[model samples]
Target: MTTLKSGDKAPDFEGVNQDGKKVGLQDFSGKKLILYFYPKDNTPGCTAESCNLNDNYNAWLEKGYEVLGVSPDSVESHRKFKEKFNLEFDLLADTEKEILQAYGAWGEKNMYGKKYMGVLRTTFVIDENGVIEDVFKKVKTKDHTNQILKSLNI
Candidate 1:
């Protein structure tokens, strides 16, 4: 769905987080960023992916990486989801799908033989300079942290 490739410059984005704080690309200028776009909040797959990241949050931090989740859900929804799951990362509220579109994570999808436009689960590993280091289109929700670590050869 996304035209963004491994070496492309990650598109600049700004959105409100669960705490209603404005967050943007510039906020993480000198750190490796794990930007994951999921279809919705609290869904089974989404939860698994997020929880795995939360469980390994310190590992990521120790490896110099920061994680951020994005979805078209509202801030209130994000807040509830984060609290329920005890998520340790910021979940961006992209209600308008602006950031999703910029990253090419919003696109048509098929399920149960029905086609509709929705968010494509994707993860972009961005370097300190904001250049994409790797793209994970086939994300393994249950083992996402290990997947990322393997990608980074950590």
Candidate 2:
């Protein structure tokens, strides 16, 4: 449902992390970023996706990539989730969803035969130059790190 595509310039984003520290696209100018947007903090899918990323956190860093997750949850919620999952990366609290909308990660969604507005499970592989290298709209939560690695052939 997003208009963003590979090779396109990544839309700028800024939000507070679980620690209430400001984070933005400009912060990772010389490294790749795995910017993922999820629906909630403790849901099954979201948790699996987050844990998978955290499990391979060092791999991403070794390769000069940073992982950042965004959700409409509050900083308190994010902090708890991170502590529960032992996640080392930052989880941005995008309560306003401005970053979500800019990256087209928020839109119409369907569940249990009902439709509503929600966050779309999406990941943007942004290159060092702030260009989108790839976009994963069909993320495999349980094995997302491998999914991305296989997709990008990295």
Candidate 3:
């Protein structure tokens, strides 16, 4: 499948949030959506990124953006991760890898000379009209939220 690019339509997905509520792209229609895909939950890098977003959650909201994280983890696992980190945003459970594949976040990844299929750390900034405004691939965990904020001119 072709990876999504700027101006591409963001894929619609149905995922359960940390609060066990179903959240989909349609639910965020008419609003800017910061949809990010990560490798796993509770890991150091993932935790840092999630926490950073949490810390600036209010600011993001003020700027009219909704932060949504997706990973190939179960809803229960997402709940634990969010509760552990006190994350205030929605973390979607993409257990089936459907959303991952649809968004082009699932693909080959290399670490220490070993290549394996996994989620490629990526972030998509969807515009209010549901079109992708920007795409950040192979994102660095640290200061990523700030980087996105800067890129969005927020």
Candidate 4:
């Protein structure tokens, strides 16, 4: 399937969160949602990016946005990552790669001169109406949160 683009209707999916709670896109209806897709949990870059979002969570909340992290990790892994870093938002377990594919975050990746299928690390800012407002592709872990913040002007 072709990946969704800005102004497209965000795909709705049901998944278990870090806390093992069932969540769906409809749960976030009427609220601005920041849906960030990362390659892995607990990895250096992923950790840094997630922590950065956690650090500025209050500011994001102040702007009336709900944050949700999605990864191809199992619920168990997500639980550990969330607890280890004290992540304040839900990290949806996309173990099936269904959501990643829908968002175009799953694709070829290179590491150590080896090519493999992996997530491309992206973020989508969806408005209250569930239409994607912004897309951040090939996110830089270090400055990712700041980029989103700047884009939202929050």
Give the TM-scores of the predictions, in the order they appear.
0.98, 0.97, 0.95, 0.94
Higher-scoring candidate on TM-score, 1 or 4: 1
Which structure is stronger by lDDT: 2 or 3?
2
What's the distance in Å from true for residue 85, model 4? 0.7
TM-score of 3: 0.95
Instruction: Name the weakest run of 10 consecutive residues (lDDT summed) in model 3.
Output: 137-146
Model 4 lDDT-worst window of ten: 145-154
> What lDDT score is found at residue 91 in candidate 1?
98
Q: Write one digit per residue (lDDT tens) for candidate 1, span 3-51.
A: 9998899999999999999999999999999999999998999999999
Local lDDT at 62 for model 3 = 91
The regions of model 3 sitting more than 4 angstroms off are none
Residue 91 CA error for candidate 4 (Å)? Answer: 0.7
> Which rank order by TM-score, best down to worst?
1, 2, 3, 4
Candidate 4 structure quality by residue, lDDT tens digits, 1-154 = 4477788999888889988899989999999999999988989999999998888888889889899999999999999999999899999999999888988889888989999988888899999999999999868788877898777676
Error of 3 at 92 (Å): 1.0
Ranking by lDDT: 1, 2, 4, 3
* CA lDDT of each prediction against the hidden true structure: 0.95, 0.95, 0.89, 0.89
Number of clashes recorded per candidate: 0, 0, 0, 0
Model 2, range 76-112, lDDT digits (tens) per residue? 9999999999999999999998999999999998989
Tell me the TM-score of model 2: 0.97
> Candidate 1: lDDT of 153?
90
